[model samples]
Target: MEISMSTIAFGFIGFKATDFAAWDSLDYISKHRDQGEWTGLYIAEDEATAKGYLSDKINNSGNGIAYLHKVSVIRPGKLITCLDQSFKTGNIDIPALKQAMRDKGINVEDTDKLTEKLGQLGYYFRCFNNEDGAIEMIIPVELVTNVDMQLYKTCIAKSFVFSCQ
Candidate 1:
């Protein structure tokens, strides 16, 4: 489960060899695979690639994939996905999240202010636990727009989160 989630996240950065997006668009793309194929969100680079993959799966393996969807992974705003068990107890692993951001060359000082700014923009953290003893923070792509660049640039000196092709 952890591996699947990480793979999905990495897809946003174009790390997957064959791009695969969820057939149901954003609805199934972020869900766990245990919920069945219909609920599983696959990652793809674009619509053509996603369609090709879907065709192959249905033709070759008789997969019940009748529809394909194109979703916009690129958003004007950014949401941080944090995986930590402490979130289940209503506590956030702020230090870990900040350190991860720092490792990505994003300036994450003034953590409180950073979160506050995100909250002001209606991009609050949504925590999820798959009973894997870790919480995953995910934001719907629709709600990931209207970013305040002024505050974003202040906290992030450099980051791929805001860079998309």
Candidate 2:
């Protein structure tokens, strides 16, 4: 009973809102803020690494199963709009930051505009504080085939067999 591991590019997609209406409403941003569920795709090097991270960081109270998909060989493109350590000190100036990004040719006036642009490109925008206490806003573009249900089932079955042994 040996578990096989490979260095695969994995993608984890999470939903901001439960329904499409809530996601598309004018107050969608506020909803996400209030619910604290604006997370996007998290890429990991392999299944084991992703499982460990997701179990610790994502699977709250052991109630949720992490959705991990084997992505294509093409690495997802990352567009880092902001990386500010001042946010850790609670000195974030929103307007000034937006102007700065505009000056940097990012073409984004606000978070909403950034989300819209990313959505149009079939990508997801996520903002969070990195481990070093820096505010990071990133857009992860998913450039791969859709999840193969049969393959996923086979992988799960093999994992179960290996674990039970």
Candidate 3:
């Protein structure tokens, strides 16, 4: 397929990481290595960006079916959420923010710390309703190709196809 800048859009780089959830212990990586491609989907702008993102993981100390998925749009919908995962991971400094709260005489704990404490108190993944506060993205996302890990790492594609409908 003849690749174009417009044709190549959103891509997701699959990776391995131990601390996928806030409840996971900090020592989790040391105690037990991740067994497979982690559940969290790290989305990138395109194939090149995905390659750059996954380059370090290729030679890392674990083996799994690493992938770069070219997601083509079948239909688009507004993905509305109160917490955008990307924003939290990219912008927020959870530890520093927690410290700032404590400094202000408000005994604040990190989400992980709070989650752990709450778990001990028999509370799990609690939710509360909020009005008029939301974040939404209309991303057309249907996997177009499971672009080979080798192709992505080596920066060459011999037999990968992309189809957008």
Q: List TM-score per model, in order.
A: 0.29, 0.37, 0.26
Q: Give the per-residue lDDT digits (tens) of candidate 2, residues 16-91.
A: 1111111122343333332222233343323443343433422334433333334232344434334455445546
Q: Report the alpha-carbon TM-score of model 3 versus the true structure.
A: 0.26
lDDT of 3 by residue, 1-165 (tens): 010111222333231211112222223323433322121123443444444443343333433223444433232221212242333334434466346435644344665353233222222121111222222111211111122122222222223222211
Error in Å for residue 160 of model 3: 22
TM-score of 2: 0.37
Query: Which has the better TM-score: candidate 1, or candidate 2?
Result: 2
RMSD per candidate (Å) reads 15.6, 11.7, 15.3
Judge candidate 2 against the unseen true structure and give its global Cα lDDT, from 0 to 1. 0.35
Candidate 1 clashes between residue pairs 3 or more apart in a chain or in different chains = 19-44, 20-42, 20-43, 20-44, 21-42, 21-43, 21-44, 29-41
Q: lDDT by residue for model 1 over 1-165, one digit each (tens)?
A: 011112122113211112223223333334432342112122333333333343343333443323343333343444445545555564655666656656755565543444443334444343434333433333333233321111001111122121112
- Better by TM-score, candidate 3 or 2: 2
